[model samples]
Target: MKKLTSLLLAFCLTLASFAQQAFEVMTKKPTPGSTIVIEYMPRNTVLQGKKDFEATAYLLEGGLPRAVEVPLKQEGGIFRGSVKTADSTRAVFFAFAKDEIRDNNNDEGYYTALYDKKGEEVPGAHAALASAFGNFGGIWGLKRNQQKGAELNKKEFANTASQKKFATEYASYLSQSKDAADQDALRKLLTERLKNEKISEADLTQTRFFYQNALKDKAMADSVAALLKSRYPAAAQQTELVAQWNKAKTLPEREEVYQKFAAVSSPANELAKNRLEFFDQVIAGMYADSGNYEAAKKYLARIENKQARANALNSIAWKLSGEGINKQPKDAKAGLDFSKQSLALVDEEKKAMKNKPAYLTAKQYQRNLDNTHNMYADTYATLLYHKGDYEQAYAVEKAAVEGFKRKDASMNEAFTALTEKTKGAKAAQAELEKFMEEGKYTPAMKEQLQRLYIANGGTQAQWTSYISNLEEAAYNKFKAELAKQMINVPAPQFALKDLDGKEVSLASLKGKIVVVDFWATWCGPCRASFPGMQTAVNKYKNNPDVAFLFIDTWENDSNRVQKVTDFVAQNKYSFHVLYDDAKSKEGNDFVVVENFKVEGIPTKFVIDRNNNIRFKAVGFDGTADELATELTAMIDMVNAEGGDVKKGF
Candidate 1:
């Protein structure tokens, strides 16, 4: 009996020792298939515990069965778990402390609850009260120590409720602290709540009020706009509502509100000329958005500041470049000069500001200048082709691209790496697998990557191919928009003289099918299509149902008019060819490039009897037979009166 008592006492001593030195785990959240790194403060007082804490990490499955033990380590104040989950989409985990580690009879050590994909909190995770330095009692600071015979109180806990409370408090704390990361979290939460239809207009209004009046911040204005746009679109469109608030009373504030009002108003409100300067910046934005590049250029040019002027020039250059307007040698030169001017202005700004990033107005001018330079190179190369110097042009392009390569090497490398990582074997494969996950890749993105790629000596073939793809995409996008405006639209009014030298208004052809052919003597395509155009005129000569009007533009040669007259007399062309000499009203209108948006020669627009444009053809790439066939088909279609034509394309 004595020997048995001695053995029992020895076991008790071992258990006691284990309880004194053990480490405890308060709580944990382990993401599946990832290393869970728990960062901690620099100081830790839990290194010398008396008992070994039997804290175990478990992956709960099927009604909370026991899980396999994984290794854990405590370094500094942080304790790390070594277990990782793989494809365990529905797994949960928890950790517990042994009873021997308890300091008080009450259960109070540490507990970790986990969740599965649906985020349901796990159950049965509890830690007993302990006196060790690493335990929750030590971390939280003990109010009092329990005596040897203290009575324990019975208690029940809900893991989900506690986690919810903790998460809410933590978020509030983060938001109050103005942490940048909290912004993302808040955005995500609001977005999710809104998406799930868990938020209402009242909720939005209250939040916006708090943000605007209580918080006195504009950060939430965007959120309010988004909410209004989603819930009350009509209200969102009412710009006067913003002014009704009367809270935004600063000059900048009034400017912004007035600009918003201007945006939705057709022809803009009758803003006084003096007041124009108040919203100059906003006016510039409006002009740019409307594709009124000339207006934008004019307004921006009027600004006295060099920085503002340079910025405006850059903006205009960008719009022109995208339209392929810079492809014209003269326009290309203008763009180049504008770019240089922008760069010079930026340089002056830098000198004035001592190389600081302070010029908010023209901050992007440097980048724009670079882009203009590259575009100028492309335009010059194409112009060389017109000058009968293809070889020299190609040489220039090679040199320019090579220089671009040297300047942006590192950026190119990173871009190449990203592309290789992202691109699939083909466009379809890439698009299906990855493209839809992000956004439509834009010109700015392509330009950035390609410029870098060229600088880094990256694969020219790959870069050039990507550039071509981007160009095709942009062209198709713009062409689609243009086509929407052009298909079956009223031909814009054109005022010009007839063969009788009398002003023949386009309104005169309001009741007949009018075919307008824009041509030039020097254009090879125009010369080639002349015979076909003559045939078309003869086909409808005696019909009295349609009219054919030919326009002669770009008359550089001395005998252009005489040659056209002589040809018309000899061949009986039958169509009226108006001389669009320089400074003519027609010539001035053509310079605007807005009437037809024509970029090439031998362009034609077929108008119906009711003064609506029925069809437009560019370059006359088709043969005489095709032209006649198309014209006949159009006349027959219009004559049938299938429907009234739509406007603007």
Candidate 2:
């Protein structure tokens, strides 16, 4: 007995040591409804040397997965946190991040299966894990693996309750799978379920989607749809309403469609309320386009959700202000009114504080509210400034700057311009100089500052030196930050057709440094980032070792190539645009983007000579010079490495 006890103790110690290497779970056999303590050791992971860390627990509860931010406390060299699993918790996937740096266990993610009293994996646990690997993983910043997810999902299909519960996810997996056998199996399963009348409404709905979208079998999909309409008329009507709304081109047609839909859909239905709000916003925009401010305001007033209404009003206000002040100058009054309404709505929301979404933490919710308020206030101030209300604009912009802590560049620029109007050129010059030294000024702000400097008797040489010093300082700071985010991941290889139909392959550019940017024509951030991208491309045009390739993905138009061509030509951007037109056997596209595991557009990857992805940048912050500097620094860093390191994945 002593010998047996000694062996078990040794085994347990080994297990504990292994677990402590990266993450340690205190509860060895964590069951549903129990709280589990997790200790994260970031000694050698991507989050190494980060002082603060955040933990997001992706929990599967009641057949639905939700992300909950779990607070962590630093204990010596590790961070510790605990999460309470609900009785229905099937699995939990943990993701750790410090701002943009994430440690998703190198994309495999850190997760564990929940158990029952009998120590067996709970029902739907595999399905939840599958979702963590496939569908929900990308949304949570974890790499998606559809094949692995589908394999896991296959285990739960035998359980009828689980099948019904996860019908949508299962159908999604079936649609994404490129295997002919998998497709055939899904069709067979659907036929069997339909013949036996064993499928639920959810299952039937997903089945129709699979046939229509994935298999492209319109006749079969229509047959299933008709059956669904006969069985679940309410769900069918909701779907048809959306289809009709999408088909409607004119405002009157949309209004008629909404009236028909409203007559059938109940006010109690959340979907109905969302559709009504959407229709109201669309109609309001149409009226505004036609210069009918009264009709627009009437439609906007019908929107029930305060935040949504405020957002719609702010969007319209910003659009009108941009057009009227810069181009037309006649819609300024209408924009000001809309801006006031938006500000009032935002103020009311701040007072109420009862519309916080469930997904955000209290702190996050407050931060979002503050951001929204500041954004609307900036718009209001801008409109006021454009309308020649200098004093009021200064006051509103001052409050916004204070609220933003002087971090927002555009707001600071607006405030500086207002300061010139309200105070004097000297006061504006002083403010601009402070913002420039703090690296909180935009390119437009810099131009304004230079104008002020030249007007204030400062020499061109002095201004040039001042700008150069600031640029050098900013470049150094950005380089240091980029150095910390450096990684050595293997770049996925591809041979794509460029705009000229000439094939370009990663293997062909073996000795050159490559910058691959994933974007779509519809992405605002992507379009906004192009100026900076153009700057970087121009800077490297003479460098034979550097190459930039912009791959357009996720576009659904039939004339996608022509649209992309026209956009690039119209913008005068000299970019070698590649079309990501590879499709799956199921006819689903965005294949290269999927392979790269990119969750969003405007994601750029810097590859070294050996094709290792040294850095990945996501999103654009609307700073052209900063983006150019950052990309230049990344390329220089990779070039300095000389491609000597071993390849990694």
Candidate 3:
């Protein structure tokens, strides 16, 4: 459970962010303009080249982003890669993300953070790029505790002498030893700074971090803690709660401190309510882990918030009722009771929604209610499956899969339309060949295509042989054959509504280089590639010749736009999102997703100004810097040629 970080449940984030420092990328001499071979080094102890880690170079050449994946190889202790580029490139951007590692989706290896070697202790981001990458996956965003001398913004350094003086001094002091005489000097400096209210927030916080995070000396920590209490008595307890509690490294220590607080904390005390309720969750998990379900149930009943309690119960029930770490019994028979209770509680809570709370909108309440139902349904089905109730389990799974066949409806509609208008498979195969040439082939559509391959029942080997060789020689000839076919196929026309309820159409974006991405909120690699997509959006922010449309497909939400909007807001991402009608008129599943035959998430298509489909890319390398680079190169080539569309290659 992601516990609430209330001044009351007391949550503190320690150990720094794992994703941010996955790789350390540095530029060699003659960095930006020169032909620099981009390299990535695993600085953190957790990384060893045991996994596939990639560093994509997004070099700015010809005023557009060009992405090149530098092939990485492990040689003993080193993980390194390099690439050749033209000298005309202005700047190179690098990002790291992980691929399939250890049987889990590891996409953290591709986040590209920007840093300028500027003479300021600012977060490493270019003005435009920083503005684009919302928080940069914590790779470049500065933490609150890291701000020492007044939490000044990056631009504040330009104010000149005093700001620069303080910045330079702070940087110098960063490496200084907190020895006896040094400690005395530092204490005097901070004491003076604390008197100035302007920087007191940063000063007191700085003092604590310096002693606690850096020095690790208990005497210094105790001395500063006393000083902080004396200076800011009202907020003294609040400050110590996170600072002291976050330092508890052991589970026993954490449990001891939580229990101590629980013992003294009054149940009716408003100040302790958030913390006490949160403590119940923590303690319950601890007890349950030790095979004490009854004790865990007792704490679950103590939760004051009905919805939060129901959600927590549902989470535990789903885990324990399944065959994972939470599995208590072989078939999870022991968890059936918990699951049943959780289902009942969630239903009861839903019926009790008499008044839409002031905190939640009617839409938000409905969404929450629907999510509760979905969670319970899945849990109930899992339990049924485990108990040998195959029929019911299949029924539930079937219903869910039918709804998810939003993909089937979309693909069939587009294919049906193509079949009706073209000369059977001959013409349809030409269109499909474009996707195959770009490696955006759909394996699921093979059966459908094979039936129409030779019209009079073609052999399986024959169908496979026709699309065989991937060599450059064969590909060039295939493109030449494609050139003989339709040269300027209009982007399959589509009219969809964006998140703002405004209609966006392919026809409306005819004069621009339209880039379309088919994705969903649940798709892991899709989200991993969002940062790189955002980079492309930023690149063309001021350009009138290019447009990026993120078509949100495979959405099961009734309020599709709102769901997309809420997700975008929570992530602080900026993208032009449009929803694909899950069930469109004319008996279609989805108009856009089908028209483009986008059966997979994160498939991207580029249409030039002449309305010629210029590029098609399916899946990404879990990078913003990489995607932006590729898009930039394509857009630039199209722009230079004045909309000369090339055959799929």
Candidate 4:
């Protein structure tokens, strides 16, 4: 009776006990250090001495392997060894398995048939090699997030009579066996050949030539021709390429043709109209070269269909805004109009056509709309500056900069979170430090970080750091001068109707100890800390000397007012709930959030009867309980300082 063996799936490692030869990469620590120990079963099968196995490990980067060969020792069906690396970065390891070598001693371990656990014949050395080569190529590409070489895929691997014989013999050996052992061996062999530079150039050229010359199909011919021009232009036969391209008929057939021409020139050149979107790209490129953005807008405006016009206008606007052309004002306004029009067109198309083509076009137009809108923002800021509206200009520029910083921070935080999730805390911290030190942070990084921070309960302190570190000193200087009016100062005074539609004023609460809380219904953490704040509100509500202004700093509208009113009613914890139209006022003017520098939700500020800020706190940081306790103690201290209790309820 055959013994039963259970199979288990382990993410990083697996241990199997079987008659089959098994490879084990043993890590000494619970979490591996830089040095990984490689173990191969049936150690007696390997040759003796430190250098016997002739194994090599690969440190893959950018789809290419940096090989590190390790000396080995055989210890009964298990080969024991270690490969050293510079740092604690986690690595996937592979080692070369070779047959008998031409040793100095001339002693040999004769090649024998390898087998799987089921006792089936493994393919011969050469055959095993070809398959391994293919596997290695695929894995290398995969690690780099790229595709394997197109030339390699199309070309014949073995062409010279000698090499052909070897491949044929190997293929024959592979065919004779059906076991996974044979397949594995073949895969391993091919991987070795891929690393050998000698094999690369020879195999690549032979394969490329075979695919180009032997495969007479127009599509294949054209692809090969284009690939050759791009990859090996000096060796390419332009005449043959031209002939193949001319014969193309179908769309896939035209892929090779387009690539061929694209290799010679840009996609915007004449005779290249593959994608409809490329039309706007071409027009933009042309207009950009001539430095006539107004002319470009004129061209864009001529498009009869709104979608097309939107696309053209969007492209032109993006180019002008990015390049900071002097004539962008006219182009930007037109682009803004076009984007709005395109949005309308997409809505109309969704309702009327509802076809895939129209929908896709609409989507493209919509993307252009967003791109143009982004450009419009920058252009509008510039226009404001030219118009001597320094404050408005600064506001827009600061918003743009903050947007970039937030995006960067969000990306950084994401990478940090992912690393922590996958590799544990130490590795994650190391990755984080690497990012910060290496200047990997970008505008996108800022945006991503801000989004992530918002998601994971961020604070004003984090935002402050984010703003300061947005760019280099010059950029920092420019940003700092602008932020002087916005940062950590007395906020501009503004008033609006409360949830009851009654007039509310900052001046009205002047004489009392005012704790103005700027909040929104959509803010998650804000809602969370409300109960704690309500406790504070209840403690002082009856005291006419104290005023708790629960101001909702969002747009003043019926929907907003209703949401706040409903929240207040459900909770039955009402202070003075008010609304703020942020659209009309800069963030620096909001009493609860902006004036008090409240970064995250549920921010609270304690104002003395003299209307001076006595205490301020940011996030609830699992410290909401602590904050409440502290606030109570502080209130007692304030009362001891002769703070009057005007009215007791």
The TM-scores of all predictions, comma-separated, are 0.26, 0.83, 0.34, 0.24
Model 2, span 185-231: residue lDDT tens: 67776776678575677778878888887777888999999999998
lDDT of 1 by residue, 127-201 (tens): 122112112232222222232101110010223353233333223222332345645554554444456465665
Off by over 4 Å in 4: 1-492, 555-558, 584-592, 595-597, 623-625, 639-649
Give lDDT tens digits, candidate 4, residues 1-649.
1111111211101222111344555543312225666665533333343343455554422123345556778766456666764332223334444432221111111111122235432222222222223343232211111111111111222223423445533433332333566555444444444455444333434444433333223454455456545555533543344466557644445445545544554334332333323433454446644666555555455444555554554455444333232233444444444344444554555455443331123433344354444334444454444344546545554454344442233234334444444456566545444454434443433454455555557686886675456434324333233222111223335576877688876676676656666677767777777777777777776788877777686434446567778888988877678775553322223443454445455666655555555555555543333344445544544444433332110
Q: Which candidate number would show the highest TM-score if scored against the true structure?
A: 2
The 10-residue segment with the lowest total lDDT in model 1: 148-157
Model 2 — which ten-residue stretch has the worst lDDT?
9-18
Under the 3 Å rule for N, CA and C atoms, how many clashes does model 4 have?
A: 37
> TM-score ranking from best to worst?
2, 3, 1, 4
Residues 315-413 of candidate 3 have per-residue lDDT tens digits of 666666553221334335656666677767767767777644533334445556755665565566556656656456545533432333322222322
Give the per-residue Cα lDDT of candidate 1 at 180.
Answer: 57
Assess each prediction's global lDDT (C-alpha) against the native: 0.47, 0.80, 0.54, 0.45
Give the C-alpha lDDT of model 1.
0.47
Rank order (by lDDT, best first):
2, 3, 1, 4
Query: Model 3, residue 306: what's the lDDT?
Result: 71
